[model samples]
Target: MTTSDDEEINPVTMLLLDQKDDDVSQPNNNSNIINIAEVVVPTAVEHQSYHLNSITSTLVIRQLPSQGLSFQLWPAATTFVKLLDSYTPSNTDPFSLTVTNAVTSVNCRQRLRILELGSGTGVVGIAASAILGADVTVTDLPHVLPNIEFNADVNKNVVGTRGGGVHVAALSWGKVEEMEGVGREYDMVIGSDVVYHDHLYEPLIQTLKYLLLGDGDGERVFLMAHLRRWKKESGFFKKAKKWFKVDVVHEDGPSGKSRTGVVVYRFARKDAVFR
Candidate 1:
């Protein structure tokens, strides 16, 4: 559904009541966005484990709700982990099946290099590093880097064993300097539940523009995993479509009185040229 028309959501913040759910379809409780201002943060530690077929044990991540939204795990991140776990050079399901010459073709080029935006708790990015054996950089605001670093360090054994590595950086979206520093060496960019705050739409777009329309050859893909909470999120997509070709590569059915589940959208340059 994209929750199409006009309204939409993402910031992973701003009036959203962050609830931890295993099966996104069922919420333990329902709360209005307005009252979310009073949402309580549990001091308890939040931990999640993702088992990787390539690794002997599971990848572990710790969430600090007391620190704020940036420290918590979001629903869309889980969806990305699911895809990364089963990714392969020959598998054509989501990458090739829906996105055409996206993922499957990318593996033939070189070692996969991925950049992740707003990597809260560093779950998806860490998982991608180990499972795909792709060198990955996980970035977010300056404050969030420590925690991401912690998670990355904790799983260094797994990443190193798989021949992939994870790097943590501080990237505040919309900062030209930060964007330029990150560079465009990556073949793919990924994010989950990143489009939450309407105010950040332009900044997020600017960062995307710099990276997707970057210097290099071949195709560069941006895969964003999102769960639409408000109809206004359409504005973000509307504005994004103007700069890049946006397509929904994956979607999960609506859960817990919601009309849409986590949706993974592939963004590429309309001309399909990275140079």
Candidate 2:
């Protein structure tokens, strides 16, 4: 029988219990029985680890129920991280200098300053730090900071070794005070799976307007990755286009199957148009 909503059962444990019960009811004389102690008990905390091949760094994350959606590693995050890895200097060592020089000139900095909004498990930010050697600030809601910090701490050594670091901070989009607290501008602003909520459209764009560099130089970049879920979610892109030029930079989905609707967009201020 299936368990009710109020009750939960581990599929592995349930299967083992069913087998034991069947063995007990059988008429055949059999002394052998499965050892209960051998069964592994599931833990409350879920631990996930990802290895970034480009930087040769590993990220360890521990998720909790309190943070809701932020507690788990999302597909968009993985996809963006893979995109970063592909562009990483290490992957193109011989041709890296040319790319690095262009990126540095655009940002006018030796190292990139990156800000990731709604950085749930800090995967993308941490990977950026380790792979690009960019100083990254991973920001999210106040309640999500603990796990973000934990993930940052676990990967601190790797980030440090790469000459990059991560800072965990609380940032609620559209909040004046919070927006003011974040620095004037960042070389690159990145986020994944942050556009799922319909109500956050205005605040998120407002926050982007405040933090994104509007110098009209096109030096700064805002990269966002999200899975297209609802038709209404397109409104975010529509609203964002008013202030920034949005372009699809990358796309990937399962092969020989329907499109997965995962896309990464690169946004930059429309210099001639921006007020």
Best by TM-score: 1
Using lDDT, give the best candidate's number.
1
TM-score for each candidate, following the candidate numbering: 0.80, 0.75
lDDT of 1 by residue, 85-128 (tens): 76665665655443334444565746568899999889888888
In candidate 2, how many Å is residue 255 off?
A: 6.8
Go through the candidates in order and give the clash count of each: 15, 0
Q: Give candidate 2's TM-score.
A: 0.75
Candidate 2 structure quality by residue, lDDT tens digits, 107-163: 444577788999988988998888878789999999889888988998898888668
Q: What number of backbone clashes does candidate 1 have, counting pairs of residues 3 or more apart or in separate chains? A: 15
